[model samples]
Target: MIIGLYFWNLLRNQQSNKTAVDRESKKEMEKLRKLRSIQLTQPLAEKTRPQSMKDIIGQKEGLKALKAALCGPNPQHVLIYGPPGVGKTAAARVVLEQAKQHASSPFLQDAKFVEIDATTARFDERGIADPLIGSVHDPIYQGAGALGVAGVPQPKQGAVTKAHGGVLFIDEIGELHPVQMNKLLKVLEDRKVFLESSYYHEEDTNIPRYIHDIFQNGLPADFRLVGATTRTPDEIPPAIRSRCMEIYFKPLLPDEIAEIAQSAIAKLGMPESPEAVRVVVNYASNGREAVNMIQLAAGLAITEGRDRLRAEDIEWVVNSSQISPRPQKKVPKEQKIGYINGLAVHGPNIGTLLEIEVTSMSAEKPGAGKLTITGAVDEEEMGGGARTLRRKSMARSSVENVCTVLRQIGLNPFHYDIHLNFPGGVPIDGPSAGIAIACAITSSIRRVPVHPRLAMTGEVSIHGRVKPVGGVVAKVEAALQAGVEKVLIPRDNWQEMFAGLQGIEVIPVDTVEEVICHAFPEWAESISERGESEGNWIDPSIEPAVQPILPFMQARSTSE
Candidate 1:
């Protein structure tokens, strides 16, 4: 009877232990449920991420190319080029959806989309850990458990392996380490990744069958790679460029920004004034920026108890966030001598207008004139292997070229003390501003006014010839944005692409004489009527644009 009682106590203790464990598990799951229930609303940008190709805005040709490259049985690897917030990532993701729908597509319903950010991807250089290329964990690693004691290596799949039979996206691909990039290239070539470890042996009985198989045959990585970068095509390595189909997405225009802003507002169920959206577009450079500005401004409106977001709210957000509007230069109504508009490009594809202005005075000592230029870069350092070479600014060189052109055209530059300024701190990268400088200097010397709406981009030679410059499309776009009525490009640079561009006349000039004829048509006509060579000193008969300051000085003296 005592033995039976002892057995009963043992059975009771086991039941109690089991119940305790069940209760503990139940409590933990309840806590998990509570944590999961606590959630916040989705961010405006997240909620508005493009779900399909149709939802992507501002990239018609880009989307077409993306479709052509991806939506086929044999999808080509792709590289998308554009600035941030221009839908490159979204287009990549959505294109895969279409690609998977094709009847002949090899991708299955369960195929995954793996993403790795080159800038943020962490890796161990010792083959211990790599998030992009699969790494083999040695037996001595912490997570190997009993395997560590047995000295077996474990292979960890990376994005490339996880992306097998699917798509692998690398954002900011140009930022990848050279070694990782090479490894990626190898995977692309072999359609597999071979993970290696010093501790690994293919014919070890202690290793698991899976490990042996992994060592024998590499992990499958037969997936298409879609890389997105903000860099220009030239910045990316040509080896990768050769392997992938290249696609370009233009910067988001103002109208596209407005559309993105409006869509975000609707998604948020927040009311906004028309001017408020216009303010966002004017200040925000792209779609993502537009959404962020809207969300912040919307929150500000709610805090202020206003029913709708106003332009003032957006302005406050812009100022507080230090967001500057896209550089804008309106065509002035009144014509001014020595004022010329030069076109330039920003980054890969943004165009901005540079206002070139010049003022000249008779030298205090004849033939000892000073040429003072403000806001033009005077010096720069060119970087190369283990050396820094100080070079004169391209802008400064262009000025020297302009002075030489002046002599070639029979105008003596040494007689005048010239102050050439690029007002508004416009960004000028190269000698593309040469023609503008020449035009401004000539107008100042000859007292001829340039057309107020004229904007020109070309490199000027000492012989007064206009030479071809890069970024013609972007430069022309900038001119169009500024309401420029006329644009002068180099004759050799002209192509049929600029033919149908409306709202601006793109005139190509071979020489500075033609530039003068177009920029100063009235003055050119007078000179032609007199029947003189296009190249001559400003007629001694014409007056300089400078007016005496004596009247203002006398008035000041009387007031004093």
Candidate 2:
């Protein structure tokens, strides 16, 4: 009976142990289930990054150029120039995948993309370490593993080596060091990276075959390079730029920003108001920023127990983010003498409207028509001194050119002490303001009010010709946003203006004469007659050389 009891006790113990094991297994599985339920959420920008080229916005031509280069049988190095947040990196990655799908493409199915920022890359000029090219780990270094203790040198692969038979995308290529750049150029030329080490002996059989090959035959670095930067061509290295196919990515337009925000909101399955979208576009400069703002607004809305994003939420986020709202330049309600709107492009595609004003008085002495230009670099507190001296000189030259144009139009600039002012004391640097300055001066001299609804941008020549200037599209967009009714652009820039511009009329002017006709239509007949008469009106026999003998003479002349 005791034996039978012992046997039953052993059986019971085994059954109990089996029950415990089952319970432990269940608990472990429950823990795993809980862990699996936890998921890390991705930022809106990353979650919404374009997975395919078709999803990219506002860069159709850029994408086409990239595809042509990547899909060809022989891929060439590419350099992409653009402002930040315009999908330079994303496009590079997607295009590679797209190329792999094409039968004629050089890319293989397993091609990899390695990305790094040139701003963060570090290189040793002593040839000791390089993150881009391969580096040798000497036995004396820490964490050398078994190879270091055994007095064998170890070769470490870098981004260039890992990206072999694929692509290496470097962001902010302009910031790379010159020494590192030269090394990269050498790698590009040879499609391999050579490693050197004092401890590495070719006679050592303990060395791995791969390490031996790298030291002897070099590491395989046959990969295409794609570089992106916010700098212009002049800022990039001539050697590097000369070897690459250049592609320019334009800044995202306001409409494009709105579209990107709308798509992001749709992807999030969140409701958003139209006004909210408009607010986001006004505050955001690019697609990435736009999506970020929407995400923040959506989060705020969720906290408030609301499903739809509101304009107030966006405004709060914008204010909290410290993003300055777009400057609103109010168009004057009434026509005023000597005041005109001049357009200027601040950056890549941001346009600002500057208000220019002019007033003239009788000179203290005959033939002493001094021109004092305010709001340019020459004037203190306008903050343009930071610009290059050449830019400042150009601004002054534009003023002189305007004075010359005035004199050519029968205005006795030598008799009047003309004071030119840019309202708000904002610096005016570009020559594009030449036509506006001339118009302001002419209006002041003729005592005729210029239309407040008119905004003009062009460089006026001494011969009264209006020369074409850059940023016509940006300037016109700024005018339309500022409630300006008409924008006068150079006739040569007619092809450069944006198509389907709404709510504002763009008038193309060929000469300063046409500008005056549009700016002062009421005096167009007199101005036309004076322009035709030319030297006859300015003849010494008919009129005084200095007509402004005093304030009284000026008043009488104006009354006449």
Clashing pairs in 1: none
What lDDT tens digits, residue by residue, belong to model 2 across residues 214-292?
8999999999999999887767889999889998777777788888999988877887578999998888878888888
Off by over 4 Å in 2: 1-38, 198-209, 328-336, 349-354, 378-392, 412-414, 423-426, 449-456, 460-560
Q: Give the per-residue Cα lDDT of candidate 1 at 52.
A: 88
| Residue-level lDDT tens digits of model 1 in 458-492 | 99887678899988888898888888999999998
Q: How close is candidate 2 to the true structure, as a TM-score?
A: 0.75
Off by over 4 Å in 1: 1-28, 72-74, 102-111, 232-235, 270-272, 303-307, 319-322, 364-367, 530-560
* Displacement of the residue 226 alpha carbon in candidate 1, Å: 2.3
Give the Å shift of residue 280 in candidate 1: 2.0
How many pairs in model 2 have backbone atoms within 3 A of each other, for residues 3 or more apart or on separate chains, i.e. clashes? 0
For model 1 the local lDDT of residue 69 reads 87
Query: What would the TM-scores of all predictions be?
Result: 0.85, 0.75
Model 1 lDDT, full chain set: 0.84
